[model samples]
Target chain A: MDFSSVFLNAALAAVSPANLLFCFLGTIVGIVIGALPGFTSTMGVALFIPFTYSMHPATGLIFLVSIYCSSTYGGSISAILINTPGTPSAVITTIDGYEMTKNGEGGRALAMAVFSSLVGGIVSALALLLIAPPLARLVLLFGPVEIFYLALFGLSVIVGFSKGSLIKGLISGVAGLLLATVGVDGISGVYRYTFDNVSLFEGIPIVPMVIGLFSTCQVFVLGEQKRTTIVHDIATFSDSSVPRMSDIKAHWFNMLRSSVIGTIVGIIPAAGMSIACAIAYNEAKRVSKHPEKFGNGSVEGVIASEAANNGVTGGSLVPLLTLGVPGNTVSAIFLGGLLIHGLRPGLQLFTKYADVSYTLLVGLFIANVMMFVVGLFAAKQVVKVTKASTDLLAPIIMLLCVVGSYAIRNNLFDVGVMLVFGIVGYLMKRWGYSTPSMILGLILGPMAEGEFRRALMLSRGNWSYFCSRPVSIILLVLIVITLVGPALRNRRIMSK
Target chain B: MTKYLDEYLPIAFLYALSAYFWWDVEDFTADSLMYPRALVGVLLVLTTLLLVFTLMKKMRLPQSKDENSPFKFCVVLAASIVYVFAVPFLGFAVSSLLYAPATALLLGYKRKGMVFFVSILTVVLIYIGFRTVLKVPLPTVTLLGMTL
Candidate 1:
């Protein structure tokens, strides 16, 4: 591969006017979505995807890249200002950020958060640039069985994400795979789950399911939560809102270490921003000299959470671009975007679509820098999203879902599918099933099925072919460990 | 309004769905049926496991215990269904103009003035974005000689 030319082309694409403007717009919107209590970064990307259908492929992707990176920063502003974390990843930031606001050091805390987010994002972006191309090169070596088990390995980790019961999560995941099998089978002309509907010939549209699960489900859940204001008091940004040199000097190690931790956690599929921040926060508390002050206006605490969450921004994209495995919900949406633009993830992406890939990578770093600048100036205004009325918000979200789904193929059936999935998603959440598992299943199921069938055909229906390959064997081992690891841990705890 | 999908109801639903899915694939060829049958079979076994876990009551499968008014959810859901139907007939602009406020009302928004204003604005913006900017072939129905 001509690495120099790829980097040069990417540099040009990233600086293109369309990429810059969309990147700016995506960052602002991402921030607002993150700052709102009910809205999320995944929802931001999913909802905005419709609006970006007309955009240039590189422009649209870079736009989403900005949104994915900046939304993590957006959550911390609300966490510091209103004591309510806008996103789950920002929950840890609230402990010290809120206390800092109470002590009139909100400015210092906010400054540190923005700085840490910037640092974390930059580090992970570097990781993505260096690691993704090599990973993609390795994926070129995979055969059908290896690819199939790799997806299974990805899906197996959802058990780790299970809130309560692993069986329930697997059930959700398997159901998603079933749903993905709807529409015409790609390899064969057979229609599996379409139920004789012409509208479903292409299968359930990804955009509709995305809008349903991430946007409409949130609308339904928030609709039931009743309208509530996130900002009560402490509703202003500090005048200076600038980090002190002393504080920066003190917490550089925490920021750097948390960034690395977040990046690594993020690269592991399904270990999302929330876990990254949680791990980083726990580690910060463990190593702090005055550990007791950790939750009480500790700058290290805010730095740890914000840095780790932002670190996930770049790291999540790595697997999505290189391996076609979404590290989290937002990256899942990103995969949908790339596919829509006719850019498949994996080997050919880094080679054939190097310009777009590099643009997204560089644009991500730019979004983080932009997030820091925007966070400095507009953090207070961003927190005002919590004040938006749910009455108005819910209907608007439904409207977006409908229009967004329809805009994909200009079909109304996608709109209907979105609504159905939304209601079903609401039910699933209320019933305590994990939605992410189901979503992952839906996204990965078809690929797994295709690979499984192809491998069988290659081996003339011999099942041993899967185990014969070393890579597939390794993946099978990974699946077993992913499934049984938690159970063994639970047993150990019980024995203790 | 089915408030809670109790253990038996969920199990029954899964059993019926899996049965239908299995029956549904009987017409397909052996190769075509492989994936679908495998999925349905898995679904059936999982549902059976769920039933066992539910009966045991110790494995503790999830139980829906939403306190939110199921009646309200039904109303909003019904409204959404109608709204989706309306779009093909009324077109994006008109249907959204009607659906947004109705949903707000169903979901307990009493501020009719603000709701209506926001609803109209949202509709107009969505129309421009989808029908105009994005150039989606949104329906321009003139049914009953009423242009929308």
Candidate 2:
């Protein structure tokens, strides 16, 4: 493979007029969605996926990549303006960002956030371009037993990192696997749990289920809020919103360090952006000359939070593109998008589908550039989204959810599936069951099952065959570590 | 008792669900049964552990902040259910026209004009985007033998 030529071609295709237009449109939509309270990047990507169905595969992916990058940055707008983190990943930003707004340095805070996000996004984008191809080549060495163990490793990691009880997280994951078994058995060619329903024969649809879980579930949540608008008083942007060169020079090292931390966390499956930002914020405070200013409107605090969260955008895709594993919930949806377009992740993505894969990778860099440009000039306008009445937006979002679900198959049955899952997701969220863990289980269930069965068949039903392979044994060890390491850490914390 | 119900009832239901699936897998061929049976077995064990933890009071109960209105949630949920059922009969456009404002009002939005405007604008944009641009062939109404 001629690497230089491939890069050149991909850069050309990404910059084509149609691709650029999709990129810009995706950025604008991402900004609006991220600026609005309760409209998360996960929901934003899920809701807009149907619109991309008619697009060329490369173009559709480019649009989605653009949204993924910009939306992570967009949350900062509201976090600074309203003291409400528009996305969960922005929660740390609210500490200093809102304080800055109170101190009437909201414009300066916004400027720092935009610059830091741009730096973070570009750094992670570079990491994706450099790291994924080599990783894809390495993953090609995996066989059925190794792949099965890898899937288990991913599930174990998610369960270990789940926010609540380990038992509940495991239950949620197992239940998701059970639900994934509802259709015909792929290997055995026999119906397992269809119960004579034709819709069940194809199994549950991923797109509709995701729309319900992330999008419609949010609608029901928003319905419970009594406030008309998200925040009563909106902070006005001052003339100092433009980025000052002096501040950028001062915070360059902090932005770079936080972005690197975010990228590393993102590459680890299920260690989401919120965790990345929290760690980065702590690190920044520890090393800062003025640690006292951290919770009291420090630009360094705002930069650390914003940069790290945006840095997660590109890092999350590295695993998804190379190993067919989603690093987080939003990337899990991206996996669904790839499957919908008949593109598989892994070696084939680099070999057979190289054009599309490279286009998406290159397009991510362009998207980050566009996000910076948009964040610079239009952030004040985007903050207006916080004032838009949730009362009005809730029903409108519900309408989009219905149409988005139905558009996938043009089947009303899919919409019903979405509604059912919406209700189920709401109840699951209200309780403490891990929704992301369940979602990961749902996505990885079939892969795990198929590989498990295939490995057994190849071994002629000898279960010991899994232990014969080095990679498989390594994966098993990793899974054990993933499960036990967290408990040990907690125990140590308690003893301390 | 109520707090215990919140913790215990869901685990009990999960146990029952797992048991039914475990029993049901007996109807499958050996190959098909192996995977689901293993999964169900795992689920049964996990749910039992959850139940035991709750009984021992070892698990941290999820904190519930009851600040929001349950009445509004019910209204929206009911409205959504009706709207979905109405889509096939009333068509997507007509159903949405009625569903949007009615839902907003039912949820206690005071501004009637903005609700109507938002509702109408949403329907129009969805029509343009889904129908005209994307070619989705959204469900349409039939009036006097012609589909609208």
Candidate 3:
């Protein structure tokens, strides 16, 4: 419980030579992945996870965290240069960033993006360091009933926030929960749906599924597009591209405010970076002195979008580390990484694994600083990655997907699973069903089922036991609100 | 009618899947069957809701676009399936070298020389990273006399 000693140990581990090298490598790789069109940050993290299998837990986490931070920042490079968002989080950046590029001020837009991302990432990282440990302590108060309801609450919120039809999202989520029951039952030691396959004994392999859903599915999408290059003529960055001191001073308040907005949004489960940036951009526009100049080459617009998305990097991890609930898709994959190393989330992360947890926290802060340094010096070079042919990139990414899935347990069956899921993911994406909802369901389904059964057993099958605990009641109310609030809002809009 | 088929067909598929799951869990012990049955029930209900909503024309799902090139997507997907199945037989490196450029050409990339170069480079780099550096034991080809 001594904060000083814990932080000191974490500091020592984070700065170790090996961890530092991993952080730098992760930052560089994250930038490349983020700058390339059709390559998302989620896919980047999922693709590189198997590489971290050989590393120490703390070092491996730091590497992945570094990727999570820089990739969010790296998306703006393509947004500024070619008007194509390298990641979904950067979609809003294209509004004003491309305008600046057309006006021969691409360098200025890039500079503002880098600086705003630095501010947002640093702020969120600090928030994660300050908020997670104390919040994790609350896990001690949760019983099986409370945990069960909490898992349900997470799924409800995801369904509410899903992009398309609510019914489709619910179906996708429920189907994922059903799929999670395939392995041997935890309590009864009886197989549910394995059907004599030995690989199904331990449940579906998460890493391969993740790689297939996020990475290989993307390969198919890119192949179908038939685009040779992301952008025919990418604007060149010049020395004068750097923002002036006056511009930074003028936009400092906007950067800080948007960063705070982004961080808060990030803390809310399933409120992803795209939403965060959209909200921040709107807030920035509302507060700007010259509202007429908002969309057409407004530096504040670029700053707001970049800062907020980067801010989401740290904010999204708080719930994952503290409560075993992922805040977004990338953090969901981080949960997979944590579990892969025999580490569980919640109070144990703070008590028994304090050293590794704190190291990861401190390492995130360093990664943000590293991202700023890399974004400044390497932005020009990394922009060229956007020019790489999708034709060539597809096969290469497919190869990585094959290797990543197979390397996890050295099983060829896992590779097959990856292919099957890859096709399934493509079909899901082509349809309106949400992939993230299904993934969240897969991650939380077992916990929900196990905890629900245990709580019922403890209560001797009394359904009223769920209502006995204050935390369980609160979670149930939250779930109802989450499910109903969106529907009510839609009704209001339609009525108008 | 065809416009709504996207929603209706998926619902039909879900109903069938749920029925299978419901029947499959019949042999499970009461304790083991409880959760799966509950989930199957939930799925059936959700699928029915989706079908009703689609029929009512109340759902606002995005219209499906016909712009995507199905031929290109199918070719790439089929090639990938073959590549995965061939890995254990032909070895990872040889299969990749053959698969990458061929797939690229199939996808309409014109520069054959660059495609070959990138493909070879990809195989060598993966070999070094996975096999040599990480010691992942990637599949190796057994020739007539030796394992390469």
Q: What's the TM-score of every candidate structure?
A: 0.94, 0.96, 0.96
Q: What is the C-alpha RMSD of each candidate to the true structure, in Å?
A: 2.5, 1.9, 2.0
Tens-digit lDDT string for candidate 2 (A262-342) = 999899877899999999999999999999999999999999999899889899888888887778878888887887788
lDDT by residue (tens digit), candidate 1, A217-273: 877766664333345564564446877789889999999999999999889887788
Better of 1 and 3 by DockQ: 3
lDDT of 3 by residue, A1-496 (tens): 6989999999999999989999999999999999987778888999888878768999989999999989998999998898888899999999999888887788899888988998999999899998999999898899999999888877887888777777788888898888888889998998888888999899988888888888889888887875566767788755465657998889899999999999999999878999899999999999999777777988899999999999999999999899887788888888878978989889888889999999999999889888888888899889997878887888899999998898879898999988988988887887788777787788788899999999989999999999997888898998888877876887788799
Flag clash pairs in model 2.
none
Stretches off by above 4 angstroms in model 1 are A227-239, A490-496, B1-4, B59-67, B142-148
Model 2 per-residue lDDT at A214: 83
Candidate number with greatest DockQ: 2
Error of 1 at A227 (Å): 4.5
Output candidate 3 Cα RMSD.
Answer: 2.0
Worst 10 residues of 1 chain B by lDDT: B58-67
lDDT of 3 at B52: 80
Model 1: DockQ score: 0.51
TM-scores computed on chain B for all candidates = 0.82, 0.88, 0.87
First chain TM-score, candidate 2: 0.95
